[model samples]
Target: MNTADMKSRHTGGSLRTGLPSTAFMLAATAYFLLPLWWLAVAASKSAGDLTTTPSLWFSDVHLAQNLQELWTRDDHIYVRWLLNSLLYAGGGAALGTLLAAMTGYALAKYDFPGRQAAFSVILASVLVPVTALTLPVFLMMSQLDLTDTYLAVLLPSLVSPFGVYLARIYSEASVPDELLEAARLDGAGEFRIFLTVSIRLIMPGLITIFLFQFAGIWNNFFLPLIMLSDQKLYPVTLGLNLWNSQVIHDPVLRTTVITGSAVSILPLVIAFLLLQRHWRSGLAAGSLKG
Candidate 1:
């Protein structure tokens, strides 16, 4: 074919490929964002206005009023619930990431007795339904007098088999064996090598693991419902459920529910923005291999 015809064919192929992918991306973005946009709009409306006004457009813009009402209600219990959620998600993610990273690193870098068995068990745990395990966990906590305590909910949130799996995959792919050997030649301890080299290389994957665990713990309901009876210890999910159930008697609470729901999602959004930078990092790991 002539050069001009060849260029024309290539242009056509690029257009055909890029157009569908771009359209799909736009559609997926809208699919995820539409509900959040509605929540923000609905939260701005009054109780009566929420139902009467358009679903995706602002009505009274009473967001500040709604926040104040939500705060002042029942001696600022909503604030307590928000704090509880932060603690559960943040603490769980931090602890879970560290443990998962270490376990995964060990599995990837070392060959020990029962190593395969350990990974197999962790993979099996990922397949098990978290809801199904909630009852047994609750029973165990009850026997240990841990039920209705912060530890009951927080402890379970700290264990994430999926995080371990992801960690192992990232560790093996990103942290070269040669780098570890180089560090060992310099007399760096195993823990020190992991801290300085492997961890730095696999940070993006660790951020992913942390985000997964954080979202899981933040949105977790069944485990908290089964484990906790104390309202003071309730995370945002359970606390919001209590508020939602109360809407039958006090109608004004509808706005609070919507507003609180909108507010509750802000932390996750902020966390994603903060952690997204790490996702682009560690591309230089292979280049730095000794």
Candidate 2:
């Protein structure tokens, strides 16, 4: 074939091959976004209007009414639940990420005895599902008289084995021994070296760990269900689940639940958006090293 014809044929073949992948991605995006779109539309409607209106389109906008009701219902219990969720997710994730960074740094950099054994234990813990541990954790918390308290939720969330594993891998790659040695030669303490050199290098990994733990704690249900009996102590997830249960009897709560769900997702979305840069950078660093 002539060069012009050959080039044209090759371009056409490439376009044909790319089209399916492009279409598939678009379809998948739509599928995932469909629920959120529905929730946004539903949140804008009253309980009566929800069934009557089109699922994806707004009608008789009652978003302000919903917010007022959401706040006034049970004397602003939803607000309390939101605060509880923030405390559990935010505080727990912060502490957990720090612990993970320290533990991972130790595991990666230190040549202590039983290092391999300790890591093996962490790996085993990671393999054990959170659901499996819920009962034991509840029993332990009961013995400690911690059940139904914020600590019951926060304490358990502060130890993420997977976060530790990821941090260790990232620390091993991102933090250099030479830097530690130089810091030590300059009379820096181990903690100082870590804070100044290693920690800065692993900031992206720490942010990833924080975001992961935050989302996990925010969405956690079973553990809190088993631990907390006090309605006031409940996070947004558990509170919403309770609302969902009551919706069968009280149809008006259906709209409240939907609105609450829509509202609950906003903080998580904002969190991801804020921290996504760090997450992306961390993944890139991991890939480059790997």
Candidate 3:
């Protein structure tokens, strides 16, 4: 074919491929964003107006009133639930991420007896669905008389096999044996090397782990439901579920539930926005190593 004809054909093929990808991206973006848009619009309406108005458009602007009621109702129980979620997600993620990073690093870098067995066990744990373990966990908690406590939720949240797996993969790719040997030659203790040299290098991986664990804990419902019977101990997920059940009988609570859900998503949004950079950087580091 002539150069001009070939160029035209290549350009046409590129257009055909790119157009579908662009369209798919736009469709996916809209699909994910639609719920958020609906929540934002719904949060602004009063209970009476929420059902009557278009879900995508505002009717009565009662955002302020709804927020006021949300804050003031039941002596600000929503605030308490928010605090509980923060405690569970923040503490659990921090502890879980640290432990996962440490375990993964050890698995990736060290030689010890039963190391392969331990790693195999961890991988097995990942395959076990969390729901199946809930009853056994609850029974253990009952035996310990630890049910209805923050530890009941937070403790379990800290044991994330998936985080450990991710951290292991990241550590194998991002951390080099030469660096560890260098640190060792400099006479740094194993723990000191981990704290100063290795931890900083693997920080992006740790942050990714933390964000995953945080989101998991924040959205956790069934575990907490099975563990705690006291309403005061409820996380926002369970608390919101309770409110939703009551919304059927009390129509006024419909707006409250919608507004609460909108508000509930804020922390997750903030977390993603803050940690996305680390996640991207971690992926880049892994890719570069590969």
lDDT of 3 by residue, 175-286 (tens): 7999999989999999999899888878887887898899999999999999998888899999989999997798898888889999999999999998888888876775
Which window of 10 residues has the lowest lDDT sum in candidate 1? 281-290
Scored by lDDT, model 3 comes in at 0.90
Q: Write the per-residue lDDT of candidate 2 for residues 207-264, one digit (tens) a residue.
A: 8889899999999999999999999999999999999999889999999999999999
Error of 3 at 3 (Å): 3.4
Evaluate model 2: give its TM-score. Answer: 0.97
What TM-score fits each model?
0.90, 0.97, 0.95
Locate the minimum summed-lDDT window of 10 residues in model 2.
281-290
Candidate 3: stretches off by over 4 Å: 286-290
Give the C-alpha lDDT of model 2.
0.93
Error of 3 at 31 (Å): 1.5
Itemize residue pairs with steric clashes in candidate 1.
none
By TM-score, highest first, what's the ranking? 2, 3, 1
Each candidate: what lDDT? Answer: 0.89, 0.93, 0.90
